[model samples]
Target: MKFIPFYLIFTLLIFVQACGNKQVEENKTQREQVIAVHDEVMPKMGQLKSLEKAALQKAEELQNSETPDQAKIDELKNLASQLNLAYEGMFVWMRQYNTEDGEKTPEEVKVYLDEQLVLVSKVNEDIKAALAKAEVLLKD
Candidate 1:
């Protein structure tokens, strides 16, 4: 009778350990899938950022030119399009920054996102300043 109780206790312990391992494995698999998806997405955002930078360059060139030409206008329009796309990506990232987001690490993701916020702010301010200066040029 004494042996029976000990045997039952040991069996219960083994069952619990098996269940815990299964749960851990399942969690790991889910995390992997999420990371795989985010890996593909981050690069696309990077491309958009590149385009946005090119657009900003175009606007700056136009501002420095003695006379605003047709080419300047065309470049501005192209820059605006790239800026819009980049802004879209920024908004999407902001929306997901708080959630699990399938990101690599929550802490690392926050750092990346905070840096992006600063960059985006600077880009927006540049666009505003450019527009203001361009308006003055157009008036004169």
Candidate 2:
């Protein structure tokens, strides 16, 4: 009978350990997802700067023209602003993101990662939208 009680305790311990491991794995997966989104957009930082500069240069050139199109100059300037905003957004996200678990529990870590994924995903969208708009504008 005593041996039976000890076996039950051991089984419970094993189950608890397994659950903890699963939680850790889940957190790892979520972290990876956040990083994936960040990686997708990070390479575009340089492009964003280049596009912003190009937009400003085009706007300036238009402004200097004898028959300057004020409307087109305004549009190019606006596009430059949007590109700069998107570029800044990435830096802001990187500044605020924390990868350390510190004293947080697994559940807390999961929540933090979830929030980060949402933020990074939004940043990704902003980057893509700005890049697309710039491309369309500069193509002309």
Candidate 3:
């Protein structure tokens, strides 16, 4: 009877261990997904900066013109500011990312990464929108 209880305990422990491993693996996959989105957009940071610079230059040129198009200048300035904000958000998020190594448990890491994924995705979208607006303005 004593051996039976010990065997049952061993079996339960194994089951629990298996479940924990599965959870850890799932968390790892989720973390990778988040990182994938980040890596995809990281390179675009430089492009966003270039767009900001171009838009600012266009704004400056328009503002300095004797017959300035106030509406167009405002639009360019707004677009440039949006691009800058997006860049800053992405940069700051990267700098503040807290999950690394085994610093956080699997569940904690997953939660943090999932939130960051949402934020980075939004930032990327903002950057793209600003770029498109700047492109149209530059073409004009």
- Ten contiguous residues minimizing lDDT sum, candidate 1: 131-140
Better of 1 and 2 by lDDT: 2
Candidate No. with top TM-score = 2
Q: Which ranges in model 3 have alpha carbons more than 4 Å from their true place? A: 101-103
Cand. 2 Cα-lDDT:
0.96
RMSD of each candidate relative to the true structure: 11.0, 1.4, 1.7
Best by lDDT: 2
lDDT of 3 by residue, 1-140 (tens): 77999999999999989987897888778778777777877888888899889899989999999999999889888888888987897888788766564677666766777787787787667767776776787775
TM-score of 1: 0.43
Please list all clashing residue pairs in model 3, or write none if there are none: none
Cα deviation in Å at residue 106, candidate 3?
Answer: 2.5
Instruction: Tell me the lDDT of model 1 at 30.
Output: 51
lDDT agreement of model 3 with the native: 0.81
Instruction: Compute the lDDT of residue 17 as modeled in candidate 2.
Output: 92
